[model samples]
Target: MRFFNTEGPVRPTDHYSLPPLERWDLNEILTFIEQKKYFLLHAPRQTGKTTCLLALMDHLNRTGLYRACYANIEGAQAAREDVERGMAIICSVLARSAQHYLQDSRLNNWVRADGALVPAGDRLFQLLEYWAAADARPAVLLLDEVDALVGDTLISLLRQVRAGYTQRPNGFPQTLILCGVRDLRDYRIHGSSERDPITGGSAFNIKAKSLRLDDFSAAEVRTLLLRHTAETGQVFTSEALDRVWDLTQGQPWLVNTLAYRACFELPEGRDRTRPITLALIDQAKEALILERVTHLDQLAYKLREPRVRHVIEPMLAGTALGDVPDDDIQYLLDLGLLRQGNGGLTIANPIYREVLPRTLAFTPQASLPQIYPTWLNADGSLNPTALLEAFLAFWRQHGEPLLRSAPYHEIAPHLVLMAFLHRVVNGGGTLEREYAIGMGRMDLCLRYGAVTLGMELKVWRDGAPDPLTEGLIQLDGYLAGLGLSSGWLVIFDRRADQPPMAERTASSTTVSPHGRSIELVRA
Candidate 1:
C-alpha cells in the first residue's frame, strides 16, 4: 500500500506522489539542456532534487532525445584528500549509474580504458568525454551533490567540466547539470599550498543558467496530500490543509512528515472516517518540534551561521533588513527556512518561529517553566490582586539572582523578568512570547482564563530613565485592541542602582479612545 514518504526519494509504487516531472519547472531546464547549455540545479537536502533528476533522466531516455545518466559524487567527499582515490570513485559511480540507466557496458569499458581511466590530472574529464563519444545520442549528465568534494578535488571537477564545454554535442556530454545544496559561485576553494588564494581562476563558468527546486506551492501541497485521499478514501479537512500550510509553508519534507505521522503513527482506532483537522496538524507540529527530528535539528543549527543571522535577526524584530543580496536570501529560501512575504522576509512557517528560540538555546537551563495560576473562582478568571502581590514578593527575594543567572546574558534582564512571570503562570495559563534580535524589546501576552495581560519588556540601557511613558502608550494601544479594561507594562531597569525587587508603583490609568484604561507597573 502507498504511504507518505519521509525518508529518501519516493518511489511510484511505495507512495502516490506528484508525477516527479511535474514537481519541478522542467520546461525551462529542458530548454536549456536542448540548447546544450550546462547549468546548475540546487535546493536544500530532501527537497526532491534527486527524484526530479531521476524523473528527468527517464523522460529524456524514453523520448530517445538524449542518453541521460544521474550520478551522485557525495562518496567522493570522503576521498577528497587523495585526488586519485576520489577520481577513481567518481568514475566508478558514474560508470555504475550509466550502466544501470542505459544498460550500456561499453560506456563503462570506455571510461576504464588505459589513459582514459587514469588521465593523471584530468582523468575524470577524459572518462566523461569518452562516454559521451561512445553514446549515439548526445549524453545528459546530472552530477548530484557536486558541492560535496573539497579543495583541489572540487576545483578539478568544475574546471574539467568547463574545459570540456566546447566539445559538447560531439565530444563531451551535451548537457551537464551540477546539483547540490549550494550554488557553485558560493564555493570557496583553497589550493595545495593551503596559503594560495584561488578566488577566480578556472572555476565552473560554463553554467548557462541556474535552476532551483522550490518547495511545493499551497495548491501543489494540497494536491500531493489529496493523492493519498484519492487512494485510501481518507480525507484531510480544509482546516487541516490550512494548518499544514500555516505550520510548514508547504516545505516538502515538513509537509510529508506531518502527513506521515498523522496517517501512519497516530493511534490505530483514531484513523476513522473523521477527517484530519487543524487540531491534528497542530498536534503533529508540536510533536515534531519537541522530537527534534533530524531535518528540523539541522535547520535549527544553521540559524547560528552568520549568513542566516543576517536575515533572521531583523525579521524577528518585525522589520525587514534592508536590501539583502538576492543570492543570500535565495540560499535561505532554498533551504526552506525563510519565506518572502508581502510585508517582507519571515520565518517560513509559524512552527519554525515557535521552534527557533528553543532550538537556538538548546540547553536544560533554557527551558524555563511557564507560570500560571489555577483553581481560581469557577468563572475561569484569575485573582489579579493576589497574583500581583505574590509576584511582587517573589521578585523582591530571588529576582536579582535569576536575572544574573539567565543564560542569554546580553538579554538576561528581560529574559529573567519574563522567566519569573512564566514560572508564576505555568500551571493555569499560556504566555505568548515574541522577540527578535535587535528588536530591543520582547512582547509577552499572558492569558489566564479570560483575563488577558499584555506586557512589553525592555532592558534599561546606559542609565536612561525608565521608558515608562512609552511603555504605557504601547500597553494602552494593546489593551484597546483587546477591548480590555487594564494591562501591565514591565520594564527591567538593568542599570538601576536600587536593590532587586524594589518596586515603584504608579496607578493613574490612562483612558483610551475606546474607554479602556491601561494601568502601568514598573519594577
Candidate 2:
C-alpha cells in the first residue's frame, strides 16, 4: 500500500506524489533545451527539485532526443575551497551518474582523457566536451545541489560550465540545468581565484532562464492525499484535508509529513476504518514542531544568520524592512521562510508563522518565574482582567531582569509579553499572532475556554510622541476583526530617558472610537 513520504525522493509505488512534469512548465523547459540553452532550477530544500530533474532526465532520454543525466554534486562540498579535490569529486560523480542513468560509459573517456592532465578549473568543461563528443545523441546535464559547493570550488564549477558554453549540441552538453536551493543570481561566490568576491552571473554568464518549483497548490494537495486514500482504503475527513492545507499551505515536505504522522504514527489514526480528523492533523503538526523535526529545525536555525535577521527582525517589530537588499529577500523566499502575500512578503505558511514567534519567545518562556496561571476563573475559564493584573505585577517584579536577557533589543518587551502568555496558554488554549512591516504593532489573540483576549503591542520610540491615540485607533480595528467588545492596548515606552518599569508600567481603562472598552497598558 502507498504511504505518505516524509523523507527523500518519492517513488510512485511507495509514496503518493504529483506528477513531476505537472509541477513545472514542461514546454518552457523543453524549449530552452531544444534551443541549446543552459538554465537554472531552484526551490526551497526538499521541495521536489531533485524529483523533477530525475523525471525530466527520464523524459528526455526516453524520447530518443537527448542523452540526459541527473547528478547530485553535493559530495564535493566537503572539499570546501580545495578546487582540485572538489572538481575531481564533482567530475567523478557526474561520470558515475551518466553511466548509471544514461547507461553511457563515455564518462570514462572524459575522466581518463587518455591519461592526459586537465587543470582543476577546466576539468568539468573538458569532461562535458568529451562526453558530448562520444555520445551519439546531444548531451543534457542536470546538476543538483549546485549551491552546496562553496569557495573556489564553486567558482571553478560555474566557470567551467560557462567556459564551454560556446560549444553546442555535439561539442558540449546541449542543455545544462543547475538545480539548488537558490537561484544562480543569488550565488555570491567568495574566495575566488580572482582575489575578489564574484557572483554566479559573472562565473556562469550563459544561463538562459531560471525556474522556481513552487509548492503544491490546494487542488494538488487534495489529489496527493486522495491517492493514498484510494490505495489504502482509508479516508481523510474534509476538515482534515483543509487543515493540512491551512497549516502547511501546500509545502511539499510539510504536507507529506503531517499526513504520514497522522495516519502512521498515531495509534488511533492507524485504523483504516476510522477517518482522519482535523484534530489528528493538529496533533501531527504539534508533534513535528515539538520534536524539532529535521526540516523545520534546519529552517529555524536560519534565524541566527545576519542576512536572515535583517529581513526577519523588522517583520517581527512591525516596521519597514529598510535597507534590506532585494537579493536577501529573494534568498529568504528561496529558503521557504518568506513568501509573496497579497500585501507584500509574509512568512510562508501558518506553521512557519507560529514557529517564528514561539522560537523568539523560547528563552523568555523557559526563564519565566513560577507563577500559577492567575487568569483562570473558579470554573477554570480564562478571566482577562485577572490576567492583566497578574502581568502588570509580574512586569513590576521581573521585567527588568528578563529584558536584560532578551536577545533582541527592539522586541524585548514583545518577547517577554509573549513568553508570559505562552506559559499560560501552553495547555487548554491557543494563541494566534500577526505582525507585518509598517503595521507599527503586533496583534495577539488568545483563545481560552469561553473567552478570547485580543491585545495589540506597540513601542514608543525615542523622539516620538506618545502612541496612545494611534494605538487606540489600531486596537479598535483589531478588536473589530476579532469581533470583540474589549481588549488590551500595550504601549512600551522605549525612550532612553524613560522611567523605571515600576514607575512607568501601569494600566487604565479607556473607550475606543468603535465604543469598545480597551485596557490601555503603558510600560
lDDT of each: 0.72, 0.87
Which stretch of 10 consecutive residues in model 2 shows the poorest summed lDDT? 192-201
Write model 1 residue lDDT over 1-523, tens digit each, in one string.
7888898887989976888788777788888888998888888888888999999988998998799999998999987767777787888889888889889777578656654546646887788788888867999999999877877677777777778888888899999988998755545566653335576543776778777788888998899889888877888989898888877777788899898888777773147576777767766776787789998888888876766766765554333467766756877877777766775566777677766655544432344443345325567577766666656655565565666564445555555555555455544565566655345556667777677777666556565666766566666666666666766666656564655455542223455444555554555
Q: What TM-score fits each model?
A: 0.82, 0.93
Top-lDDT structure, candidate number: 2
| lDDT assessment of candidate 1 | 0.72
Candidate 1 has what TM-score? 0.82
The per-residue C-alpha lDDT of model 2 at residue 521 equals 96
Alpha-carbon error at 95 in model 2, in Å? 2.4
